[model samples]
Target: MASAENESLDHVPLFPLNAAVLPGGRIPLQLFEPRYLDMLAGCLREQRGFVVVLLREGSDVGSQAVFYDIGTYVRIVDFQQLDNGLLGITAEGLWKVAVNRSWRAPDGLNLGDAERLPEEPEDVLPSGHSELAAVLRALLRHPVINKLDLSVDFSSAREVGWRLTELLPLDSQEKQRLLEIQDPLQRLDRLSSLLDAMD
Candidate 1:
């Protein structure tokens, strides 16, 4: 991962979806549209990644979609041609970035000038938040989540918070708020409150 000191605001391809992905989470995508297919090819050929922003307005299949400015920058970890003839890709979120400005290419692909956000500092899960880790462990056991083969680090506050945000039944707006938070401990606290309310 590139350190914040070395990172700068640069134009990157953007993919807007109804879902949100946080750093350390992974999402599987199916590409059939010509615009996105071309974007995938460029990213793979350049060995680079694209931003996955949560759509705020319009449809994902159209050219007029609007998205939240903060999003995850993901790299394509795996790719294959599905039996249905669509391109299947597994993307792992590398970090968070804020889109300063955006434009559309002639091909109808969205591009953004994004600045990488600083990574959360390493912090151990506090003893009071042990329940949060336990809850995440249980959630990860679900067959659907297990199939993703995600790596979990219960000792890391950031890991636990991010995984829980991805796994929980929170709305996209709620998840986006968590993603924008810079402090892992605070995020964990927020998740705990959310879980308590869900019960």
Candidate 2:
């Protein structure tokens, strides 16, 4: 007989938020609110992953609160209880996903299921992508007050572009668009255009 727990996984748990969690990346969260504190507790108790659903449209409540469906399943990689009673933590990406449903919990926090997508290729990032990366590298090279601490994670020009884009403190909406673009090549193209426009 199939276990109900196993079956529930088929319909992944949704922990929707007004944010974009990139694949091949880490999302640090402050679990302060009760609803989210419960959400994290549930994850820990069940050992089941939850989806970080992105909110796009509607009022900040009920089904209307969520918009963009794509997201990544995140696992708590590290955590600590702060003096402010908030859980300071980092969630490491496990899978890219598309939302299958959206709804509101009794507490009025957001939640939704996400269709996990496979990862992009491990090949070289396109030339255009590399160009943007060069720009970013130069920018990072110049130290500044409160500079972003970054790490180089790409092997080729193409990956370098996308990886750099991920590292930057870009807007959540823009980052969500990048995660939704499954094609690595096309993603690099889009990133190239976005970075060029910024210049």
Candidate 3:
């Protein structure tokens, strides 16, 4: 376990994306830009994690983009050279972090001073939440989703919330709000409510 003090002191390399990755969720990135390729090499070499923040404004082509302060720190788990020679990287989100400040490097890569948020404590799943798990299982039945190998324990409250958040087609802002939530049970309840409204 990492102390809160140590966690807050850790700085992270930033990669702003139009997508959101909740804690426990995994996302695949296509790396082509020179800055990102270099960042990927360094992360792979050092076995370090990087933060993925949702792009609030600007484009991925340049470092001028504005991003949400809430982000996820992810570790690369799979990497491959794509047919077009670009780097195809798969990273699993491990920590939810709050970006205290951000700046662009001379090389065009973005970096952030971040503080890791406290993880939600373990809690038992509430009753009548089987529908949530069922929905996720149905989604897994899809060929595309099944191929991703998203291993999850539906019985776990935290996994259930995070995985559902990942599988849902909610917009980036909605997903960011869920990622910033610190309570797993409340997250689940909110998700359930959202799904109910959707229905």
Candidate 4:
């Protein structure tokens, strides 16, 4: 399964943002920078995808932007031209990946060589973990996040964990840390604890 998963692609263009995107997640982006515009065009033309990572350092645009080692595989699902002429893209996050190495292209696009991380199975949500879905459902009611149009699967602990990670207003570093965790139950437990602390 690991080999089959990794066989899709080894390298992708990296888009560093101030947030993390988990598997089974989606986010919208506005493309204005020349480098990113070209990258998006290539992905659309070739039917390929790009990596969305959290910025560890530097701005999303311009040089010297460093990103976390983990990211999500994203495919453009919908797109349109904004009134300002920027490209608006809605990308669905497919899977988690660990970036092994990266470099800057002449156009300043960062390309990452990444490997697919194995996804955890859909284990039953342990007792106490069911509250995770409840918490997420409450957050989903917000006007801003509701527009994300997330689909929930309460039976799968892994799905619940990823949705919670994406919905919470955690900082980029905190979200990146969650993305690195390999155990779904542990991620869910940690997220539940973090939410408890916030309450």
Estimate every model's Cα lDDT from 0 to 1. Answer: 0.88, 0.62, 0.82, 0.84
lDDT (10s digit) by residue, model 3, range 61-136: 7668988998888888898999988889998888788889888888988888888788788877777788888888
- Candidate 4 per-residue lDDT over residues 1-199, each given as its tens digit: 1233544555589999987778778888999989989998888787788999999989987689988988888888889999988889988888888889999988889997888888767787787777888888898898877887888788788888888888798987888888888898999988988988899
Error of 3 at 107 (Å): 1.9
Cα lDDT of model 2 by residue, 31-67, tens digit: 7667777877877777666676665655323444656
Candidate 4, overall lDDT?
A: 0.84
For candidate 1, the per-residue lDDT at 23 reads: 78
Give Cα distance to truth, residue 99, candidate 1, Å: 0.7
TM-score (all chains, Cα) for each model: 0.93, 0.74, 0.90, 0.92
TM-score of 4: 0.92
What RMSD does model 4 have? 2.6
lDDT, candidate 1, 1-199, per-residue tens: 3443454447689999877778789888999999999999888776688999988888888899988999988888888999999999989988999999999999999999998889898999999999999999999899978877899889999999999987898887898898889999999999999999999
Segments of candidate 1 deviating more than 4 angstroms: 1-9
Clashing pairs in 3: none
Best-fitting candidate, scored by TM-score:
1
TM-score of 3: 0.90
Which segments of model 3 are wrong by more than 4 Å? Answer: 1-11
